[model samples]
Target: MNKQHAQHQIWRKLGLLSIVMVLLLLAACGSKDNSTTNDESNAQQQEQTTEQTTEQPAAEQPGATVYPLTLKDDSGTEITLDKAPARIVTLAPSETEIAFAIGAGDSVVGVDEYSNYPEQANAIDKVGDTTTNIEKVTALQPDLILASVTMNTQAIEQLRALKLNVYATEPKTYDAVIEKIKNIGVLLDKQQGAADVADRMSQVKADIESKVASADKPSVLVEFSPGWTVGKGEFMDELLTLAGGTNVAQGNGWYEFDSEQIVKSNPQVIVYSSWYEEPNAILEGINARPAWKVIDAVKNNRLVEVPQDPLSRVGPRLAEGLQSLAKAIHPELFQ
Candidate 1:
């Protein structure tokens, strides 16, 4: 073989080696690029998983929305009242009525059975009748639970265990009732309505005072179911005072006195109330008892029966109750 031909053959073999090396380098570069892309994708998926896990903690708690509330309760369990409650439940009719007056009736989820007024109250779930129903109340998931000192106490305690905020109310007189109404209004975010109601009540009181000056001041005896008598501090006593009458009873509060005591007092006028109207209902009671039969008011047939609406409801109509009392004391004065 010639020397030049041998040199040519060597050069061709080197060229073949160089081409194989370039192909191997390209294959290695592709594998590395694929590995890097896979790593980046896996990192992105892991980051998404972390964000999903972090979001779960936020879901565990309630959202940050504060409502305003003013809690006024005398004798009940302690509660952490942070803000106003949006949804409320009342275990007593009095509290429910107060809520209605404050314009928070729409937010009420449960009410006592005695809250039969306004017809809409019937649409809400019944907690009890002037009482409490713990299970039903808790199921409502109310942010606030309103009760009365004079109402069922056991259920209030049971509700507290469920971490519900409770407020108990007591209003013995007109002034206290106004204050209560205002506080309830604040709790339900009805400050304006409450103020208006209080202002109106004050005006009504002032008007009653003006009207009462010319009326005959009679001595009165108020009786209720099962022979209840009004004493000092009772709403009836307050009404009588406004109506220019003297409620002749002991202690000036509410009580159940013996028939002999009522007969002996011998009020100039006797007032009777019942769930229903039957003239004999009041007449027979006094007739059956000889002591009452001889009383001056009874002998003179000076007993009066008031309509169920104005006499029973202690809400806005309480002002009307006082007016009725004045009319009964002196019909000519009202005219």
Candidate 2:
């Protein structure tokens, strides 16, 4: 062969070999891309499967309460219910509110005079207040008598003496109040309603805490009644703390605070309950006090008048009260 022809043949062979190598590389890259895409698809499928397995169905979840249920009250008294209470009577305002909140309103045969919320409760038979009329309650033929261990001690004893079922509640904290509501739901066969109320309360509390989490806790004084204040070991105190305020009241439970102590604490915000007669007069009286003029709450015009029922009563409306209190304490954050 001629030298030129031989060189041309060698060049042709090299070009063909290069083309084949390029084709093989392209095939390998395509295979790798396809494998990676398949792996990602499989991972997503597995993740979805895991999620499906972890989630429980409504049918599989806890349902209605079994019959003949027995439970203990806050006072540690054991009581058994043969069936859900068809007719119920509440001796305390808190218990009445809980019953109404938990969808047991229709079942409430009677309520104390102070159970004045929900408007419908006012139409119910008045069975008196903390000191309920045992005869009136008996006439209602209540299968369950809801009372407060602290507020309706005498009524509970009197009712139980007449062979009545009295479940008295005495929750000391905010969480305990929620638990009590849930227990009442079980007692009245209104579990779903109770859960809904509890969840709402929890959400309200969480939202309030989150809003005030970064803000500085201000010194606060809560006067639920005239010349009365709540301290540690009470739900009101917990509400104050949760609303991002440091309670100036010292001691545990309810107590009377004098003008001297009020001047000493010098709270930045003062929350007074409007339940007392002549709320405007009460505010005027506070403002007129010569020593209180030097106090920060009075000086800065931070005197907040709150409704008496929701805050003072340990009931479903307490969360609403907390929100109101939070707004009063941290108006800037709320606004």
Candidate 3:
């Protein structure tokens, strides 16, 4: 009976050991499954991160101008160039300003008398203004001649007759002016410089529009000369529109408006070019006019004087002109 009891206790101990071993094996298998799941999750996270990096967009780069490049001028005349022009002659102040602004100032060997904004242009040889000297232009032996279709009509014709490369421009709107600048840049192989100028002008325009978006557009009259005002289809007219003002002049292009017509329009803002003779006297004359006394601009003394070069020349400085007009028309928003 004693031997049987001892054998029974040994069997009980063996049973307990077997149960502990089984529990340990099950815990090992569970740990292995959990480790495998964690590895798979880590791999998936890394793959998604790589895909996001690969989907990023590349930065834009400036394009190179291919030579023997042929393009149409603002005058709608097609011109071809064998290579970048080394010697250039500008027949207008706007062209001179554009050439200099595009980093091709050194290439300008001759310029019109009015191209005086960049001190460098003033140092260059003067070709002509209103009427270009054909002999002087020929003597320069320019590879490229920049002219204005409107300002240098006869000069362009004469130069072209002489078998010279004359690229004429006549930008009527603000966007047209910017496009002209970019086009000039391409001709001069200064694409990056032109792009920079265009970007700045666009930024200024965008900023002004954003500021004046909610404001009311005031009635404005831009008198570059006595009795002379710009109407629709001109950069000045577009500048007024962009500056948040309504041009009071009637008809298209530049024209003379009678005192009676101006009185009827009754513009809220009177913007006159500084190029006018006796600006102070002119302002005084407008203020003293008894008929114009009822006009809001005259009554409130809202006469703003802007530099003629920036406003008149459809060049890089046109952006400056736009800002000045905006400040004059919407003083509160700018402030």
The positional error of residue 241 in candidate 1, measured at the CA in angstroms, is: 1.2
Q: What TM-score does each of the candidates earn?
A: 0.73, 0.80, 0.80
> Which parts of model 3 are misplaced by more than 4 Å?
1-59, 276-285
Any runs in candidate 2 off by more than 4 Å, and if so which?
Answer: 1-62
Please give, for residues 110-160, the per-residue lDDT of candidate 1 as tens digits: 876656556788899987642366788888889888765444456667776
217-241, model 2: which lDDT tens digit per residue?
9999986544556677666788899
Clashes of each: 7, 0, 0
- lDDT for each residue of candidate 3 in 92-124, tens digit (9 for 90 to 100): 677788899989999999987656758998899
lDDT of each: 0.56, 0.68, 0.68
Q: Give the range where candidate 3 is weakest over 10 consecutive residues by summed lDDT.
A: 25-34
Where in model 1 is the C-alpha error above 4 Å? 1-70, 76-83, 276-284, 308-313
- Local distance difference test, candidate 3: 0.68
Backbone clash pairs for candidate 2 read none
